[model samples]
Target: MCIQTELQRFQTEFNQTLVQTFSQLPNDIAPKLHQAMEYSVSNGGKRLRPFLLQIMAKVLAIDPKLIQPAAVALECIHSYSLVHDDLPAMDDDDLRRGKPTCHIQFDEAHAILAGDALQTLAFELLINADVQTDIKLSWVKILAQASGYQGMCGGQSLDLEAENKSVGLESLANIHSLKTGALLKAAVSMGCAAQRNLSDEQKQKFERFAELIGLAFQIQDDILDVTATTDALGKPQGSDQKSNKSTYPSLLGLTGAVHKAEQVFQSALEQIEDLPYNTQPLMDFAQFIIKRQH
Candidate 1:
C-alpha cells in the first residue's frame, strides 16, 4: 500500500481507540473538566508520536494490542503538553489545529486543570494496561523522563530562556533535542521495549534512528514556520520569529536549515538499513517527517 494510505489506515484505527478510551471516562468527573480534556485530545493533528510508537511496534513484531495503551498514553502526554504550551504564560497562542486553543475555547484555569488531568490520565492508562509489570514499568520510566525536567520540560525552560537572546547552533540543537526530540525518541524506545528479547545493539540502532529523525523533524518545522502559510500550518506562521526564539532557521540560514534537515534524514534512513526487520514503513515515516509542510 502507498505510504499515505498506510498512514491513513493507522490514523483511523488509532482515532477509534482514542474515542473508545475517552468514552470510558467516569461520568462523576466534573463535566467541564471532562469536556475540556476530551476537546484537547480530540483536536485533530497528525498524531505523529503515537504513529511512531505504533510503527515501531510493527517493525518489532509486537502485538498492537500490547502496545495500544502506550500509544494512547504517549498521545495524552503530547496533547497535554500542547495545552500547557499554549497558555497565556507560555506561547500565548490563540489557535491549535486550526481551532481555538484550549485556553481560548475554555477559561485559562480550566485549560490548566485540563492539562494537569490529561497528564495524570496518561500514567493512569499505562498503569491499567494489560501488559506485564516490567514492560509497564519501563514505559512509565521512559515517558516520565521524556516528559519531565530532564527532557521536554528542561528543553522548554531552555527555549524560554533563549528568547530574544542570540543562541548558537549547538545551544539551539540542545534545546530542541530535549524539547521536541525527547518524547519522539521515547515513543520509539517504548515500542522497542515491548519486544521481550530485544538486544542492546538493536535498541541502540532504533534509538539513533529516532534521534536523527527527531532533529530533522524540528528542522522541518522551523523551515515550515518561514515557508508555509498559516492555513497550511493550522497555526500562526512566523510565530517563532515573532517570539524571537532561536531555531534551526535562525541559527542556520533557511537554505542551510533545509540542507541540514535532509542530511539528518538520510542518516536516519541509514540506521534502519541493516536491521533484521523490514524498515520500509519507518523509512517512509522519516521521509514524511522531513518533507511534511506542517
Candidate 2:
C-alpha cells in the first residue's frame, strides 16, 4: 500500500481505537480529572508513537487483538509526557495541536495532576495487558527507564538548562537522544517487545534506528517551525524560536540542519537493511518524517 494510504488508515484507526479506550474508563475516577484526561489524550496530534507501535506489530503479522494493549499503553505514556511538557514549569505554551494547551484549558495544577495520572496509567495498562508476565515485565522496565529521570525527564531538564546556551554536538546529541529519541526508541522497543521476535543484536539495531529517526524527527520539527504555517502545523509556527530554545536550525544554519536531519534519516534507514523484509512501514514512516512540513 502507498505511504499516504497507510498513514491515513493508521491515523483513522488509531484515533478511533484511542477514543474507545478512553471511553472505557470509569467515571468515578474524578469527573474533572477524567475530563482533563480526555482533553489531553483526545487532543489532535499525529499520534506517531502508537501508530508506529501498531505498524511494527503489523510488520510482525501479529493479531490486532493481541497488540491493542501494548499500543494503547504506548499512547498513554506519550500523552502523559505531552501533558507535563505543556505545563507552566515546562514548555509553558498556550497552544497544542492548534487548541488550548492542557494547562491553559484546565489550569496548571490539574494539568500536572493529569500528567501524573497518565504516567501511572501507562504502567497500569502495560501490567494489565493480556500478555505474558515476562513480556509485561520487560516492557514495563523499558518504558519506565525511558520516561524516568534518566530519559525523557532528564532530557527535558537538560533542555531547560541548555536554552540560550551554546553546546557541542555530543552534548546536543545527548539531549535529543534523551528528550525525543528516548520515546521513539521506546516505541520501537515496545513493538519488538510485543513480538518477542527480535534477537539481542536486532534489538540493538532497532534502538539505533529509533535514535536516528527520533533526532531527525525533531530536526524536521525545527525546520517546520521556520518554514510552515500555523494552519499547516496545527500549532504556532516559530514557537520554539519564540521560546529561545537551541535547535539544529539555530546552531547549524537551515541548510546545515537539513543536512543533519538527512544524515540521521539515512543512518536509521540503513539499520533495517540487514533485517528481514519487515521494514516497509518503518521506511515509510521515516520518509514521512523527513518530508513532512508539519
Candidate 3:
C-alpha cells in the first residue's frame, strides 16, 4: 500500500484503540483528575511515537494486539510530557491540539496531577501487559531510562538552562537527543523487544534509524515553527524564536536547517534500505517527518 494510505489506516485504528483504553480508566474517586487526564490526552498530536512502535510491529510480522499496550504506554508518556511541557513553568503554552492547554483548561494543580497520573499509568500498563515478565521488565527499564533524568527530562533541563544563552550546534543536538530523541528511540526499542527474536546487529540498525529519525523529527519541528501558522500547528507558531531558544533554524539558518533535515532524511532511508524486512512504512514515516506541514 502507499505510505499515506497505510498511515491513515493505522492512525484511525490507533485512535480507536487509544480512546477505548482511556475509557477503561477508573473514575470512581477522582472524577475531576480523570477528566483532566482525558482532556490532556484527548488533544492528540500525530501519535508518532506509538505509530513507530506499531510500524515496527508490522515490519516484524508480530500481531498488532501484542504491541497495543506498549504503543498506548508510549503515547501516554508522550502526552504526559506535553502536559508538563505546556505548564506555566515550562513552555507556558496556552494552546495545544487547537484547544486550551491542560493548565488553562483545568487548573495548574490538576494539570500537574494529570501529568503525574498519566506517567504512572504508562508504567502500570507496561507492567500489566500480557508479555512475558522478563520482556516487560526490560521494556520498563528502557522506558524509565528514556523518560528520566538521562533521557527526556534531562534534555528538558538542558533546554531550560540553554535558553537565552549561546549554545553550539553540538549542544543543541545533545539537548534534542535526550529531550525528544530518547522516547522515540525507546519506542523503537520496545517494538523490537515485542518481536519474537531479533539479532544484535538488527537491533543496532534499528537504533541507528531511530536516532537519525529523532533528530530529523526535531529539526522538522523547528522548521515548522518558522514555516507553519499557529492554526496549522495547534500552538503558537514561532514560539521558539519568540522565547529566544536555540533551534536548528536559529543556529543553522532556515535554509541550512532544511538542508540538515534533508541530510538526516537521506541517512534514514539508507538505514531502512539495509533492514531485512519491508521498510516502506519506516521510509514513509521518515519522509513524513520532514515533509509534514505541521
Specify the highest-TM-score model's number. 1
Which residue runs does candidate 1 get wrong by more than 4 Å?
none
**In candidate 2, which residue pairs get closer than 3 Å at backbone N, Cα or C atoms, i.e. clash?**
none
**For residues 1-294, what per-residue lDDT tens digits would candidate 1 score against the true structure?**
876788788889988998998889974669999989988998886889999998998888899889999999999999999999999999999999799999999999999999999999999999999999999999999999999999998998999999999999888889989999999999999998899787899899999999899999999999999999999999999999999988888888999999999999999999989998999989999998799877
Better of 1 and 3 by TM-score: 1
In the predicted model 3, the residue pairs found to clash are none
| Candidate with better lDDT, 1 vs 3 | 1
Local accuracy by lDDT, each model: 0.92, 0.83, 0.89
The weakest ten consecutive residues by lDDT in model 3 span 1-10
Best by lDDT: 1
- Candidate 1 root-mean-square deviation in Å: 0.9
My TM-score estimates for the predictions, one after another, are 0.98, 0.95, 0.97
Q: How many backbone clashes can be found in candidate 3?
A: 0
Candidate 1 lDDT (Cα, 0 to 1): 0.92
Query: Each prediction's Cα RMSD?
Result: 0.9, 1.4, 1.2
Regions of candidate 2 where Cα sits further than 4 Å from its true position? none
